[model samples]
Target: MKNCIIIGVAGGSGSGKTTVAKNLVKAFKSEDAVLVAQDAYYKELKEMSVQERAGVNFDHPNSIEFELLKKDLETLLKNQIIERPIYDFKTHSRKEETITIHPSKIIIVEGILLFAVPEIRDIFDVKIFVDTDADEMLLRRIERDIHERGRTFESVRDQYLKTVKPMYLEFCEPSKRYADIIIPRGGENKIAVNMVIAKLKRYLQKGAL
Candidate 1:
């Protein structure tokens, strides 16, 4: 099997990192690329009450099961299939089901805190940081959490003020310095996204992976 290319997409919540990741997958075709979300590896909170889990600072690096994520990524890089976990944001816990992920030519790992951890940062062949204004991100986040994550507007706003913004400022923003590419305006910046795609295609052509 040919070597796989691992791309890390990091940004604050609602920064459109997912858009960049999706565009990359679309660029390569889903058959050639697989997307892995770090949110799925949120440390299982089975031990905590729902209320307690809700209060947990998910934006922190300590909240992610990086060891498991590292193991799965290593397995994928070795051209092996692995069972990826599914996390339920509404319940703030893991689901029993897992999705099987096969090795692909490209793997896009997208997360808010991927770069906050050194071990996770070292595994990426390309590191991308999606930058967006905090106000814009907060708006997007509020909408997403309320509509999709079953969160109320008040709760989302409270969480943002209590933990999200603080964590982003402390961890996510600082991690931007490590990015090989910084995408402003998130995934909507077609020029930046295309540039990344072109670079990856060239690397594949050169068998760099």
Candidate 2:
């Protein structure tokens, strides 16, 4: 790729950023687009006990290794492959094995904190934010945690009240001002998704010419 474009997608947890990112990737050829998640670079909690790790505030920016994410993005942008870390949600730590991501023409990086952190945020060529209602976000989060993270309703609710909502208000919501595009109603908004895909295709076409 002569000109690789890095697109950053940000939104609160359960706000449909992941869905939007996935749909965006699906709109293009697999080789031309790839989606990377910021959660993959979560800070290693090996020193803490599993129980203790469960109590860690994952929604906070401190809990993520943005420097590593930045480095990996740089590597991919340089037309190099990266050994992307595999995070074990059950263990709340990184697994030994890493996934390999080859260079691609379009990179979509989705995370809650990307827009909140200047070091990582400033690197993106295009920034997107997905806006979803708080009630809807909480509901989606509850369902996701129960199914994916092996959490109970009580624990998920407690964590949402303790960290997720508060952190999102402080960090994620405020960062929306930085976004070049804001997709409301998330991936369910087909028109919004189509528009974004169209814009990206146009950009790539311009680069090819």
Candidate 3:
């Protein structure tokens, strides 16, 4: 992992941050890059009841286990292996099992509030923010929650209104000022994605020098 590059992809939930991260990973190939999702680092709620956990404000920065994430990233940067946590969205807690993630030349960190914290933001060589319209993001969130996260439409809408939108405005949106690049229209912007890939290639090549 000599000259390993860490890229941070930050955006509102359903704003296509994951899509951008996935595209970058595909471009780099699995052997050369690793994707670490911030969502996986959500704080375990073992002490809370299911009802209480359901009411928790997941969008807040305090809800993530960022210390663990930072340690894992540091380990990866040192060319070592780390065990990443497994999160269960349905249960609102972590699973006992962990996934073994090996160090790679490129590490893509994808999360909604990554750039909001200075400790996390400072580690990234490239910080990207995906900018999609708020209305569109809400629609995508509703769809994803219903189909993938086992959430009911009413619940999704309620959570979005109660926590998600406010948290995004207070934390996620303000972090955009820290971004090195902002991609509009999220994953649909192929040009922006390609540019990012090219920039990464340049960094890799320069490191070789």
Candidate 4:
């Protein structure tokens, strides 16, 4: 069998990086493709109080369990299955159990800060950055966090205004230079998506699927 291909999709919060990654996974049509999200690696927060959790700057790179994540991905790349951590957004904690992931023909790792760390960045065959307007992203983040993450609108706005927005500018946006493709306007740009799909198809057929 051909070796699996690892693709990294990264962008600012609510910038549609996951949307694009999902579409790419579906386009592959092979059951051998797996989707892994960076959100799943949020540091275990069991002992921290609500006040302590609220004080966390989640947008920071240190907020993720990078060591564990890197080890898990390495196992997956070696054709071995691994238990992936499951993070609870509402509770701000890690679940007792993890989800199992089997070896796949393709791996799509999506995150807001995928390229921020050099260790994780080196493993990807393809790196994508979803570029979207700040105003639009903030609006989408507010709606998603309030509705899906069980967060108050005021808190969501506060977090975005304070940590999220600043981190995107200082950490996420600057990492765009490392991407193989810079997708403007995120998933709304079909041209960029189609191009990525085409390139991936070619790679898949070239004994690297």
Candidate 5:
């Protein structure tokens, strides 16, 4: 089996990182290419009330269970299957059922802080940073959180002001230095994604697909 090509996409919230990763997956010839979001590994908040959990600084790098994510990737790299956690954003808890992840030739890990943790960074063969303007990011985040993630406008603003912005500056932005590629404008920039596809294709030919 070819070695699993782990690609990490890190960026500010609503920077269109996931969109780019998904498009890149579509560009791949093999159906084994899969994109996994870091949001899926948010630490289970079963003990806390929904309101209290909402107050949690989810934007913090510490909020994710990176160890388990790393282990899942490690297993996948060895051609093994693993169960991924299912998180409920509305209730702020984890569901009993898990999403089964089978081995893939390419794994795209898109998240806010994938490169913030040294251990996780080392696991990725390629690291990408999606760059976008802060104001636009906030606007997109507000819309998405309210309509898709069951978040209130006030709460979203509060979190962005208190945690998201600061955490992004302190953690996410700084981690850009670790990226092998920095993509501006995220998904809309087909050139960047095409470059990524080309590299992956070359790597695959070199027996490291």
Candidate 6:
């Protein structure tokens, strides 16, 4: 972790930020890099009823446990392993166990509200914003939530209208100004991704010098 580079990938839900982060990881050897998803840091809702948890505004910055997320990243930066939380999207709570993440030279943090929270955002060495059309975002969200996240179409659509779109306007969208790089055309923009990969390699190379 001696010259570790922390990259923040931020965007609206389903904006392809996770895809871009995965692309960055693909550019490096596994031992040299790791991906930390902000989705895993959602505040534990053990106290809430299932119905109440379902009503929670997941798109808001307050829904995430940013202090713990920052601390975990700081732990990794110190060349230590961390017991990363494992969240269950279906259950809307964290699992009893955690996964261990070893230190890496490159850390890619991907999430919708990543840049909106100052405590977490301030720690990033590079801030990347993935830009996509709102309509496309909604489409992708609907697809992913229903298939991958075990959410119903009605639930996904309702959440988007209730929290996702509004929260993006109030928090996530405005955060684009803090980005050092804005990647257009979503994650399929290989040229933009490659440019970033090249710069990241240079950063690691320079650290060796």
Whole-model Cα lDDT per candidate? 0.93, 0.93, 0.94, 0.90, 0.89, 0.92
- Native-referenced Cα lDDT, model 1: 0.93
TM-score result, candidate 6: 0.97
lDDT of 4 by residue, 1-209 (tens): 54888999999998999899999988877576889999999998768997788879999999999898899899998999899989988878888999998888889999998999999999998899999998999989988988898999889988988899999999999999999989988889989999988887887788653
Ranking by lDDT: 3, 2, 1, 6, 4, 5
Error of 1 at 177 (Å): 0.6
* Root-mean-square deviation of candidate 3: 1.4
* Superposed model 2: Cα runs more than 4 Å off: none
Those runs of model 1 whose alpha carbons end farther than 4 Å from true positions after fitting are none
Worst 10 residues of 5 by lDDT: 27-36
Question: Tens-digit lDDT track for model 3 on 1-209?
Answer: 25788899999998999999999989876778899999999998999998899999999999999999999999999899999999999999999999999999899999999999999999998899999999999999999999998999999999999999999999999999999999998999999999989888776777641
Estimate the lDDT of model 5: 0.89
| Per-residue lDDT over 51-83 for candidate 2, one digit per residue giving the tens place of the 0 to 100 score | 999999999999999999999999998999999
RMSD of 2: 1.4
lDDT tens digits, residues 73-162, model 1? 999999999999999998999899999999998999999999999999999988999999999999999989999998999999999999
TM-score of 5: 0.95
Give the clash count for each candidate.
0, 0, 0, 1, 0, 0
Q: Measured by C-alpha RMSD in angstroms, how accurate is candidate 4?
A: 1.5
| Residue 93 in candidate 3, Cα distance off native in Å | 0.6
Task: Score every model by TM-score.
Answer: 0.96, 0.97, 0.97, 0.95, 0.95, 0.97
Writing each residue's lDDT as its tens digit, candidate 6 over 51-125 gives: 899999988888999999999999999999999999999888999999999999999999988888888889998
Candidate 5, pairs of clashing residues: none
Error of 6 at 133 (Å): 0.4
Model 1 TM-score on a 0 to 1 scale:
0.96
